[model samples]
Target: MSSRIREQLLSLLLEQGDAFTSGEEISRRLQCSRTAIWKQIEELRKEGYQVEARPKKGYRLVHRPDRVAPEELKPHLRSQRFGWSIQYHSQVLSTQLIAHDWARKGANEGSLVLTEEQTKGKGRMDRAWHSPPHSGIWMSLILRPTITLAQAPQLTLMAAVALTRALRRETGLDIRIKWPNDLLINGRKFCGILTETRGEQDQVQYVVLGMGINVNTLEDFLPDELMKVATSLAIEGGRTYHRVTLIASILQSLEEFYDAYLKQGFEPVRILWEEYAETIGREVRTETSQGTIAGMAVGLDPSGALLIRHQDHLQPVYSADID
Candidate 1:
């Protein structure tokens, strides 16, 4: 079945909402033949949608799988750009790798690549990200902004602020931004954002922003070391959450903040980021490629670098591990 017809069929079933629609009515509504409708219904069943067919009443939607699909998310999305066009996968090596290729092939500005399981998930410095199957949010967004290359780092901070705000409102948990990219809960890490740009010397062609969030993973299932340093919303909030809903909230929030950051400049987003930042005004030890620097975390610079107040000089760190 064609992608267009597949989506329309699911949409119609969902709209009917427990009530069965006759085959004649569906064919007339979608302008397709009864044979085509039957094929598409079978396709939906293969994709995990439970559809019931009866002699008199044609089809009824019974159950929608827990997996996140664009058809399932369209009704919940409020964003104009983000998540409008999506590439969803059950498993992949990394969504970032696919997103980069999609960007090069003329994918939309806000095209998103999402995966339920990532076998080789990546973190900062190529560190392994513990992404269990069907337990976390492993996704990437392709962004083609008009900002200069020098201003790209601010996007990471802006995303951190957007996700932090949305997760707090959705989960009702205390989540804080830890320096450049990580999100913390009670001093334990819960989320990480990675931003990579593909461009020339003076221009930014596009950016692939990858986000990994531990939503419903249980704490006891994690490794010993990860249990000490990592946590999830289910663990912190004492309950599980629907990943589809969380994805919609995140996309909506990021698109809102991203539009504002572009029109109003980084100052506005910076202010909001500082509001939920746990790194500011605290003593920190950062391990940069240059060396390890331990000092007081003062504020962020214009380019989104973390500023540290040492002996007498203030230093800006572009990338580091805050220990």
Candidate 2:
């Protein structure tokens, strides 16, 4: 269904409150035939909306689903740019790959690639990310920032800060950023972010930020290896969360931080990241491709690299898993 007609139908149902609105009444209000109204109602049902239709009572809106479809998010989204253009998929290989392809084809900045499940989702260092159907938030955002290639890494920290703040506000959980782009709650991982950029020399053409969050994933759905280290909002909070609301909140937070970083600098993002960082001033073991380095996590550099005070000098780490 077109967003306009869906919006009109939802508005009519919402305006009616507990009362039922007949198909003829909706047809006249939306300026469509009764058949069209029925079809739209079926579409709404397919999207997880509960619409009750009786012989005489007509149609009544019962419940709204927690899906992350465009129509579901349009009514809740508050951003001016981010999430304005969304490519929603029920299942895909990876949102990062699709977003990168769209970015290369000149897709607009702030365009979002969202999926309910990913067959081959990956994280930093090419690790498979478990994305169960209708249980997690697996998305990638296409950004055409004018920042230099060197400054692009800060976007990962920016996303971490945004996701941290959004989850804190929504779930009231004690969320913390673990290095480059991981969110932990009570020392268990719940979110991971991977950022990919394509550029040359000092200029950056575009960046695709992939985010996978375990929202309503149950314990049985997780792999045996991940069961100990990973967790979900439902497990932590003892309830399921509405994915649409969380997505809208994260998009708004991202747009706010992205604009701030562009106009001001990385200082604002750095400060916010530090406030929510879980690695600072702790004994950490960073495992990079070269080898493992164990030291005290001092802080972050201006460019968002993890700074580890390894004995004599402070070493800057660009990529690694903190243990």
Candidate 3:
């Protein structure tokens, strides 16, 4: 209810595109109290929107900030389905987990679950993701595709490709995909992608594409252990960037690449992914449940599995803990 009201208020103000709006007029139109309208106005201000209030004039949206509200991001978003519907939480245990639950309850395809801060956020292989308050992009995308379970793994690579393209356009960061899903800049970890799916034996019900990118994380906020290994957009780009814009770009690219993948197969995205991939043709080591393997990263199979060229053998690694 509040979400609808907030969106409606934004739309009204955007349509008006004037200096100010009267409380009486807005309250009557929204079917809410003037106090309720004022509170929502305050909420928008808190999210970086510059809402100017006057005793006689009521409220005026002076500037639309670059936070990731559905309405604020709507004009910038270019996706047909991805992020068309969004659920934003100020703080949550995990957006990915919440997205999974929402998907189970029949959320639409490309529904976004996002949070400013994640308390129990996780990464690939149950690793704890460091998400400081309002410092990064901690979000999950719910994608319900008409594909077999085998094709699910390809989505992570697709996301990496999409995210890389966005970074290139937005920040112009020299980013690369580190094999399976990690995004790197200047040989350091800048982003991570984790793909989890829930479905039946031969069908995929919904897949959660969880992506975490260090946008503006401060050195003080990071754990002492990760300060050396992790890098943020602020660190790499040397400037502060709006997370909302980056997210909108990512969703747009994801939608484009996804549609192409569905029609033409992974060949196109595979080419793009390989071009930006840093791990391919590099000497690396990865840890699997079985053991550690030292090999040369050849490329990805059609299923998005890593093909490692070990001594006297070529192997397809299903899952690996990249080192």
Candidate 4:
């Protein structure tokens, strides 16, 4: 669906400033009915905006808060492919599920599916992701790489490197990667990445990289069960940072890393990924479908498969539960 009209409606509302304009004036100016204006305004409210309607005085934009609306974020986005077709939702079951469907239906590579909140969001290993309504950045990037399926794991590592670079540049908060695909702040979890793919053994049709970041969310907003395990940017930085800037930074970094990976292969990206990886060279406990493996994390192979140096030999861990 084209968000241009809704965006224009939002822009007109924002341009009017604090002046209370009549609904009839808005309808005449935007060439729409007062009811249409009222409906869109209510939709904006559902997306975490604060608009005030004072009797017959009409609608007043009390606040133009940072929302995932295309109008609010389009100006800040600098991607050529990523986010070119941005989808915004007030609340959804999962952005990953939406992105997967879009990809299957021929959504362009780097197309973004974002929601202010995700009701059935997912994390690594089909875990339930905590996406509070209108509190964090829930997004999924649809990527169609021409690389072989064997090389697909590199994309997850590549995403971690890209996100680390983006967080450092945007929030100025030192972020690190925890092994495969978790972002850490001060040794605590801040972000989780779930990379799901659909393809054959030698070729990949498309890949969905879903990232759930705790942006301006407060500690109290999270459940007590997660308070100690999960953290947000606000908790780490002690202030609220703009979500648009974060999104733009991530796209830019992802584009750069993706370009490098496509041209130079995963060697360079893997080196950078390892530099930011908190699991490398650290003692870790890994759980996989086969069983569990405890060893000193050596690093990653050229194919982005993690290398765990166990008692008698170096084991190539394709996928595992990391600790």
User: Sorted on TM-score, highest at the top, how do the candidates line up?
Assistant: 2, 1, 3, 4
TM-score of 2: 0.94
Predicted structure 3: lDDT:
0.86
lDDT of 1 by residue, 100-163 (tens): 9999999989999988899999988899998888888999999998888899889999999999
Alpha-carbon TM-score of each model against the true structure: 0.93, 0.94, 0.88, 0.85
Give candidate 3's error at residue 77 in angstroms: 1.7
lDDT of 4 by residue, 66-165 (tens): 7776788776778767887877888899999999999999999989998888989999878899898667889999999998888888899999999998
User: Compared with the true structure, what per-residue lDDT tens digits does model 2 show for residues 1-323?
Assistant: 46668867886886797899888888888998888888888888888889999887789998987678776777789999999899999899999999998998999999999998999999988989999899999999999899899888899999999999999999999999898789998889999999999998899999999999999999999899998899999999999999989999999999999999899999988888889999998999988876788899888888888889887789889977778
Model 4, TM vs. native? 0.85
Clashes of each: 0, 0, 0, 1
The reply for model 1, stretches above 4 Å from the true place, is 289-291
Q: What stretches of model 3 exceed 4 Å from their correct place? A: 11-39, 42-50, 55-58, 62-66, 288-292
CA lDDT for candidate 1 = 0.90
lDDT of 2: 0.90
The Cα RMSD in angstroms, rounded to one decimal, for candidate 4 relative to the true structure is 3.6
Q: What's the CA error at residue 245 for candidate 4, in Å?
A: 1.8
For model 3, give the RMSD to the true fold: 2.9
